[model samples]
Target: MGRKKKKFILGIDLGGTKILMGLFDRKFGLKKTVKLEMDGNRGEKFFFNKLIDGIEEVLEETGSDLSDLVTIGIGCPGIIDIYTGTVKVSSNVSFFKNYPLAEKLKAKLRVPVFIENDANAALFGEQQFGAARGHGEVVGVFLGTGIGGALIINGHLYRGVSGGAGEIGQTFLSIPSVSDFETTRLKVGALVGRNAIASEAGFLLLRQKCPHLLEEIGYNVKKIRSGALSRAIRAGDTALEDLIRSRSRWLGVALANVVNVLNPELVLLGGGMMEAMGKIILPEVRSGIEACALKPLMKALKVVPSRLKDNAVILGASKMACEILKMTQK
Candidate 1:
């Protein structure tokens, strides 16, 4: 059975520590947007209610109505079973082991709902309207609490056998250990995620006793956000900057492996961390890739920062809904 048409739509981007919601009209033009702080440990029910309330709040703010809303598209982290709209194993969201997120949200609002991996949604948005426009082969590496990735091949998103393709974060790489003769093998996500950097900053403070690290982060590792880290580096924290450069280099090496395998024409480095530290980090990453990737692949590859930044997911999600709406109409 086909669903009835409505005059508006909603898109949400759910991150580890932030929730961004955007309201769109029938034409997919953004009407209003609201951002709320998120804490995964607050439990499922509480967060669920918060989502509902936020949705209602946006409609009220814009003088819109729930009855006019058609579909909702949410982009969340982790493994999403797009076929069934289930979010499975989102490590960032502690409460979501495996949940039918789209079904539950649809039941509450009586609207069609769709869920996609956050990285996938962002890549789609970029491909259609942002950085990767007109690119047939692309790779998106998003650096946040974790490293999320998506791949585009032949102008399409490539979801693997289980709807989880282009996920480079889990790929294992060997890094040099403190002992010259040994190497450590670790997942890209675990090795270069924001938490990894935060931990490094904390360790830097303890070992080097850098006064600026304390002043910037104040002992709590979570406080060492991308902006703070960038500021500290700019303020003459050479050791910390070097550490971040090393991490970025590792990410570059990881990308090199990916490029050698996929030979994508474009590689985009993005997310909140990139937004804050792109100037300092992008070059290091490119240098790393240049150090490792094949000469032929490097010749045609374009490495750029994501133009939409954080807005990519919400916009992409909304665009997804609009596409569905258009399909149904035809």
Candidate 2:
């Protein structure tokens, strides 16, 4: 008789825009995947319902009963109490505050469940199966609607006091509360987290200076496609090109400070903006690091794009869940 196939784990990546779930075998090969849109306006009832629905769909598609699964890991956006499996606050999904997602999933699914911050999951995913693999100290920097950062030290996540240690997106460029209130610079998240900022912000900052080369964003904001702005740059839109360049400059400024303090050996940049505009942003960011970073520390560091594509979070979640299960078994 043929050897039976080992059942795998379920991994979920829950974000503001969508929820992605996947089933992976013992080898971590993906067996099935599903994605669901999060209609933010519909409120919490619909959100949770859709979330469960996606899981159910994947379970059915993979032909693996919930009982056959080893464990489940969910990477959720926002502040979460990892020890207690509670979601403290999620700017993406505001309804959940100190919600015990792990306990709730365990009750309903009747399986072990582990929950982690999305960025941390993504960082771990990359470390275990993607870009930063072999590195002892690494930083995952993702630039999306807002910036997200996760720290991995000595091959383990560094969850500081209160599990909110890696909220790097909230890091400020300059508060400027002391003077020049009008010229005061606000972080990208503060200016553009709610509404689509890539086009609006990029246009407003660049259009008037060079209107003859390109028009404004043209209302392509509905789809939430970040690559469009970068696509414009590649197509030779001077305004957007300049905007991306400046953004990278600021990115360097912010990241240089990170390097000075943490001095991580590797920094992997991911998320919508980095994936879309990497070519434009990388040089400027590197220049800033070279200019401002401490010589010895900066020399030892390397920044690169993440290699996991879109599966990093899910894969990382599965690995963590599997590890937890093994520890419990021992």
lDDT of every predicted structure (CA atoms): 0.86, 0.77
Question: How many clashing pairs per prediction, in order?
Answer: 0, 0
How would you encode candidate 2's per-residue C-alpha lDDT over 42-117 as one tens digit per residue?
7778877897899889988877677778899998888878777899987787668888989988998788999998
Q: Any idea how many clashes model 1 has?
A: 0
lDDT of 1 by residue, 1-330 (tens): 866456788989998888999998867688899998888888988899889888998889998777878878898998888767898878767878778998889898888888899999999989988999999999999999889999999999887887788788888777556763343237788778888888878898887655676786677887888888888888888888888889999999999999999999999988988998898789989999999999999999999999989789988888886786668779
What is the TM-score of each predicted model, taking all chains together?
A: 0.92, 0.88
- What lDDT, from 0 to 1, does candidate 2 have? 0.77
Which stretches in model 2 have alpha-carbon errors above 4 Å? 1-6, 178-185, 191-196, 199-217
